[model samples]
Target chain A: MTATLDRPTAAATGSVVGAWRAVWLRVEGRWTWYRRHWTASLLASGLQPVLFLAAMGIGFGSQVRPGPLTDGVPYLAYVAPTILVSGLITVGVTEAGLPVLSGFKWKQDYWAVASSPVSSGQLFGAELVWIALRLTFGAAVYLVVAAVAGGWTSAGALLVPPIAILAGVACAAPVMAFAATTKGDGHVFAAVNRFVVMPMTLFAGTFFPVERLPLPVRPLAWISPLWHGNELVRGAALGGLRWWPALGHLAVLVALLVVGIALGRRAFQRRLVV
Target chain B: MRSDEAIISGTGLVKRFADFEAVRGIDFQVRRGEAFGFLGPNGAGKSSTMRMVSCMSPRSGGELRVLGMDPDRKGPAIRARIGVVPQQDNLDLELTVRQNLQVYGRYFGLTRKEVRAKAVELMEFARLTDRADHDVQPLSGGMKRRLTIARALVNDPEVLLLDEPTTGLDPQARHLLWEKLFQLKQRGVTLIITTHYMDEAEQLCDRLVVMDGGKIVAEGSPAELITRYATREVLELRFPPGDQHAAVDKVRDLAERVEVLPDRLLLYTEDGDAATTRAHDRGVRPISTLVRRSSLEDVFLRLTGRTLVD
Candidate 1:
């Protein structure tokens, strides 16, 4: 067909739309890569969650009593929702950060995509979508384990999927932005986990309320995704949503997801367009 | 893509890495169904030009059109319609040969059934039907390269781009790849290839541009280049390494042109037989003598003042 008219004129309009469609296909192909490797996913998603639920919820629940520590509720029930949110954070971090970087540089997965018709923005979107799917697997399995541990006091605990998804989006946003800007393996992510996630999981009312922390340190709970997800999950599970505060937490996570995806898109454009 | 009148055309194409000029300034055109080649050595900017043409890297400065679409703006459209065989085999090591084709076909937006059919056909074309389900990691370098070529063909591109298409392959592999490419040409597929081998240029390219240090030093058909820049035949002389310079000086005027190297002497002449007689009359007894028809290598050496291989 190039012999009749001109060739360059046709390509300009096509590359963008082509890039978008190509990315989705790449996501499908990458996901299909683990079909035969289901044994690993089986261990991580099915078995690991049950083990964690038993050890962290049942074993540790016995050590901490109700009322003074868990607002007079069963310790296992109180800790279960918090762990569900934290589990999302764990899976989201792995799927969004290290894997993203490895695909782009270390493993040269991005090179394979770039050489194709796919654009970088589209690939990044597909990457996020794939991560979201992986997060769902872990979150759903953990929610089932939470239910089996008798974590629910209200029927609304069935809304675990939405709550966990929101938690994942909220948690994945900053990590996505940070991943886009990452050049080499930086200690910044490691520090975020150690100084931020670890402390937040330990102190941000995962086991008890923020009021139990030092009077001045209670505000630290506002910045953690774990706190927001915890509030929503715990509020629904224990039949005690503050209404206004739950909406506020949900809004913060939405904003973070927007910012993260936007930043990631821009970074992909900047890095790949050259 | 445009009406496919001009598969590729460029005006004042320039590509540079920092201040280093990879392609200083070149203007060219490639019509559909034609086979074009860039014959140059390493550091000759052949790969750089190929990259720019493929729209993977931006041109430093130029007016370039591929399939009548601006490469800078419509990279995906151009790429979708083109098949690329890079110098190195960049096959997906994680997938099977059939899956590699299937996945690459999907990247071009082929439907599921379309890719499946394409995979089967490509595996047969590459003669890897038996290894279609095997992981690509264990495949030989030649098999991998064939699969890469097969993957490129999944999209059924109008124009194909190849860079050093058979650089490291054994003769059998190179012959098979060449046969496949020839078949594509017969089917009216436009091909743009870059290579440094004289024989490869002779066997494939209808027209070629010879480049050295980012600038095209000459441009012609394989035979035309030899006729223009080199004699019809060449006489080679190998002397003791230590006395090469003295031997070259002793027989400087015996041939039409004399190129003195550290270990050998190249005597360019219209009749290599006459040159041999002249050398013999001059009392020059070389360790060895080889007289053969001139080739692109001679033309390239004559224009660039250096050998093609290191």
Candidate 2:
């Protein structure tokens, strides 16, 4: 013990490499836990999205014709890309809420990490990095399953997975901020799922075009990141994506992501550093 | 093992919550390789002081230096060399017992090979080698506590801060933990422990401070505090509930001081057996009587006029 105590660890140096090493170690902690429980997470993040794609894109799309709303692509092709992004919205909301709060109040792993050399900002960055990785992996699995089910119409569909990942993180970051403010009680997350997440997924132009809805309710889709994500993905997959609307969608998602990251970082710092 | 050099020091340290002060202005220093303790009851700010020293909480309006570095600025560097065992065991339940140690070592940026080797050594030291592969959630209270301590040592820290390390453990478990801490002290790790248990302070600390209402009432070694604040021995006499006050008046002049409890009257003196004899000769009869050596509890009672544990 005396010999080991004389040898300083990397964090004792307080160098940039040491800071990034702390972040990577935190990510490794999450990965170590995920290794044992990947089966359940795979079911939620991967299989569920593919199942939704099969059920809605094939089973339901057979009844619909190529209409102006779908830009003359097959209904399966149109619905596949939107479901990919919307499925991630559900995954993002689920991942961000209870787990973040549990890390603070119940399991208290965040507090455990807090006492270590790791700073709160570094922990926040590691959490988002891990979330982004999970979204990327899940999107890849969903896209492969969709291609097997005859959902891909063009090589342009490769762009949808990256777009889905951006939107998933955009939704997750702000919800993580809300979770950090909650006390141990999980009822608020249930309300978020019931009142906010469910409605947003349903009306975010995922199932049908927002144009078919009443005039007054159209702004609801316009304000949703998921709706923008759905538009960008569907447009790119079917080869009709225009430049100006694409940039607008990109800007909306990026703005949400930047704002969400800022709030999430501050919330984690306030909750943990105290 | 003690030193004249102070490894940790604070000057008029204060900690304020939003509307309440948890640690009022107080000053103390800890020498290297010594078992130092903060003895107080609940809400006495012992834990707050420990947090400040561990770099987990910032002091509100005072200077605190741990290992000659400012905690507010050099927190990560200082924390990298210190281990904290919080009041509660916050072990990672997602990992096995061994992984808990390994992963905690990684937080300090230790290499995977180093943590793997360190985990095995610590598992043996904590007596958890048999339970190494088992999940942390199913371990008993004592095992979890031992593992928490072992995790704190993953960095081979120079100082270990234990906040109420044995609050909820059974007696046998507590003795086991004390032995482990004693070993650490022998190996030259500076220990700063906060506990409400007087006997634990007596057994572990070479020097300590008695805190009440977030202020230091007395500071000395266990024997020195007993000599300074209290008599060498104490005589306890328990009568029927209402008769203790009458007994206190009868034994008032026979001892240095007398404390009247609802059920018992205490006589503070240099010789407990002699005091019991003198009181018996004075015709102060009681249901039960005993003579004992004075302890830290007696010193705390004398200093603050209150018991150390509620």
TM-score winner: 2
lDDT comparing candidate 1 with the true structure: 0.78
Whole-model lDDT per candidate: 0.78, 0.87
| Top candidate, metric lDDT | 2
CAPRI band of model 2? acceptable
Q: How far off is each candidate at the interface, as Cα RMSD in Å?
A: 6.4, 4.2
lDDT string for model 2 (A1-274, tens) is 4355344322232112366777788999999999877987897777777888888889989988988877787889988998989888888888898988988888888888888889887888788778888888889998898899889989989999999999999999999988988875888989988987788788888888888888998898789899999999988898878999999999999999899889998999888765
Identify the CAPRI category of the predicted complex in candidate 1: acceptable
Clashing pairs in 2: none
What 10-residue stretch in candidate 2 chain B is worst by lDDT?
B1-10
What lDDT tens digits, residue by residue, belong to model 1 across residues A57-91? 89977787677567568888887777767766766
- Candidate 2 per-residue C-alpha lDDT over B22-61 given as tens digits, one digit per residue, 9 for 90 to 100: 8889889998888999999999999999988988788898
TM-score of predicted chain A against the true chain A, for each candidate: 0.85, 0.93
Query: How displaced is residue B282 in candidate 2, in Å?
Result: 2.9
The local lDDT score (0 to 100) that residue A97 gets in candidate 1 is 71
Give candidate 1's error at residue B229 in angstroms. Answer: 1.7
